[model samples]
Target: MKDDCPWFLGYSGGKDSSALLKLVIIALSELTSYHKEITVIYCDTGVENPVITDYVYQTFENLKSECLKLCLPIKYKIAVPKLDDRFFVKVIGRGYPTPTNIFRWCTDKMRINPVKQIIDVHPKATVLLGIRNGESKQRDRTISKHSKSEYYLSQSGSKRNQIFSPIINHSIKDIWSTLKFNNFPKSIDSQKLGELYKDAGSECPVYRELPGKSCGSSRFGCWTCTVVRKDKSISKMIENGYSQLTYLHEFRNWIAEFRDNTEYRCAQRRNGQIGLGPITLEGRKVILDKLLDVELKSGIALLQKEELIRIKELWQSDLKNPNYIEKTAHSRVVKVKTHPKPPI
Candidate 1:
């Protein structure tokens, strides 16, 4: 309350973030005078689990109405990646392989950078997160390494912006209690969240800093995530009655396998180096066809119209000069390790 600088709250529609938001709203309500404006930011990766995405959109609507009703100084924003950076545009248009642990490239483009762009406008803004200490051993290590105090952490590469985690010390049990018991706003439905948790697990962080977990590790993450060998959260959701996810689940599995298939990849890298290159033009066509089929079967708009236009533009440009570098002319060559083929 003392600092009057603008505050940006990162909300991932997860239990921890939900609990933290509840506390923030309650705190703001009790304040006699507002010192600063608070903006709740959510990064929609475009490929988020449909079930969780619906819930989050509805919750945002509810929060907007309720905050106005209570006369709280709060705003909401949904951040999204650029057209060229969207999942399908990269994978299908550019023939980029689906992300893997070693070559994981999706998180920054789809998640963090979108949110970071917002924060960058406010140089002195404080970013409030819902990170807790014991969520995982790696998380715990990260917290300890960057902690400035009980509630503050160092925002790497930024000396001006401050990072504050209100629930840094909150336990898993504490988070549940806060969500289940808090009655204000009435938008965060603890029961609904519980059901999601029962089927899907935790959520990926909306705005991760240095040393953070990649996307697809949570229920609220991208449905097209292939970083993990299998997306257990979506699988569980399908088994637990989310039959609509069947096609998406199958496509994710298929694409993960297809990404490693040598037949579908170019012989030269985009940088002109000799290595496992991007998906071949033929491979990209196959992917787009299959993705469209999945969209029709699942009744989900996986690719936006603008994204498709962008993809076509990219494809046309690539056709003009298919090779990034002429393999014979390049002096430096790197041998790419072949990956084991997925089960046929």
Candidate 2:
């Protein structure tokens, strides 16, 4: 509740976050006359697009310079998710399946955990989020819930070290307008950022099911995201001549093809009943075997290497029990171009 409590600004290097940062800085400058300390936090997922990472660094530098000019005590911190702690690690290493829409597991592990740790360290801080109502229906629900909490908690919850979204009420148009009005700091490469957004065909793959709902800003996301059906941001990189991203694009396809594999999935539900649908474990396993073949050719592991080894081990163990493995693995239809055979 104290005004002196530090502020944690969550900057994801996206348009919303960038705009929020600018607004937060503007507000802090006015409040600095009264002595306020604001710190910026960027959760690094290690899988952020390179361009996004560059912009984040550049923007931080610009903010630092501005703080120095104004004699403010705002600091910047970056947090990263460990590779061993990723979804692949769990799926490949521990025999957990990839997170699905109904059972989304990546968010809590990757996105929320890293940032929450930083927030927990500074319990007496006002967290600055970059949620804009225009982003999505879910965002609207989140903002509405927080707004209600603000009133019940008192003082728009501003007096408490509560979450504050400065631009929550603003529309997407308003964000661009504000940035344009101020000629946005040179630290951000607006042109390239614009291009990235235009090409970003999907949303952050942290939360499952919503493909094309997230965009790759500059940083902080899982390197292997199968949830995103089309990774336009990575594709953009390839389009712009960043050939390394080609592997990423191919990897996504490999995962997609593998998701339907029967050999890789269980025939019976965890409850031990053969599912009653055309989409049975047998079918899934068959698809998975074909997918595995493609993945082998592609050399992209959907799960981590350790996870894969464990899965294979499980398959071996399951084989001992005839009813367990059941040879659920099946083949998929592969189109092959053929030439006329010579007469025998």
Candidate 3:
């Protein structure tokens, strides 16, 4: 008998991943003669909307029920990053500049790291990611390389990591059509989620420092992303009567303002000498005061408590360093009530 390799299906509560999960479930059911373990893993950043989290949990329950019905041995796991206030950690906690395309340190820390940790344990496994061709040019290049390469680089095949993206060939329309025809798993409210997407009408911001400016008109990301000049996600949420989201929206808006004020950034790099251009002295003071005010008024710790401790320790160290000096706070920038123009 041939050895059965384990399957690690990546679940991201998105439509593509959900569809991929359904297909995998169906395929595994038909292949009942084989004795293989399938583990569905969802890497949580602890920042997803409550609705998304609920959907993830409910989907697992439904999948488990299906597995039992089919008498299959399919297990599931959900992993979340340390409650490290990722956004709050660097910006408010350590006073790092808001993320930009050039400095997208958040994705790896919050999105990729937790999943990579799981993969490390399953050194020899076939990992399935729901990356579709229509997603982006980067994804296209990745898939093309995987198709042509001797080993799948994404799965780290050199370490016996096998990546299988069955839906890479499917189009967005095809995916939705399949879901619509098959009916959304009872776990998720297709109608409500569809409404949310329609209303949100924002793309996930891959770039943070200047979201719309650099990445385009997308906001499906951290509520506190300072990259976009204006946060459409917050605006859409508020418009949809999610009043609680307003605080997050306001906070993000404030953060964007801080990014424009360059002074808060380091004159010299994290090391001693200047790497990039210097952030003006005034900009630095503006960013620090604003960040401190946001912490005080919002009464929300930007990073996880432990991360905050680390950030504060770093701040203290920077204060004492001869190369870097802490400056006094400056006057705050008053937010204009009028809605600003969206990214062109």
lDDT by residue for model 3 (18-84), tens: 7777777666666738667888878656445534455568767877786787777778888666555
Instruction: Enumerate residue pairs that collide in model 1.
Output: none
**Candidate 2 stretches greater than 4 Å from native:** 31-34, 82-84, 149-161, 199-223, 265-344
Error of 2 at 272 (Å): 8.6
Best by the lDDT measure: 1
2 or 3: which has the higher lDDT? 3
- Sort the candidates on lDDT, descending order: 1, 3, 2
Give lDDT: candidate 3, residue 13: 62
lDDT accuracy of residue 289 in candidate 3 = 56
Best model number under TM-score: 1
lDDT of 2 by residue, 97-201 (tens): 455555456666666667666766666766777665656677555456546455322121223346666776787788767665655344555665566566443
Model 2: ten consecutive residues of lowest lDDT: 335-344
What's the distance in Å from true for residue 112, model 2?
0.8
Cα error, candidate 2, residue 319 (Å)? 14
Cα lDDT listed for each candidate: 0.82, 0.54, 0.56
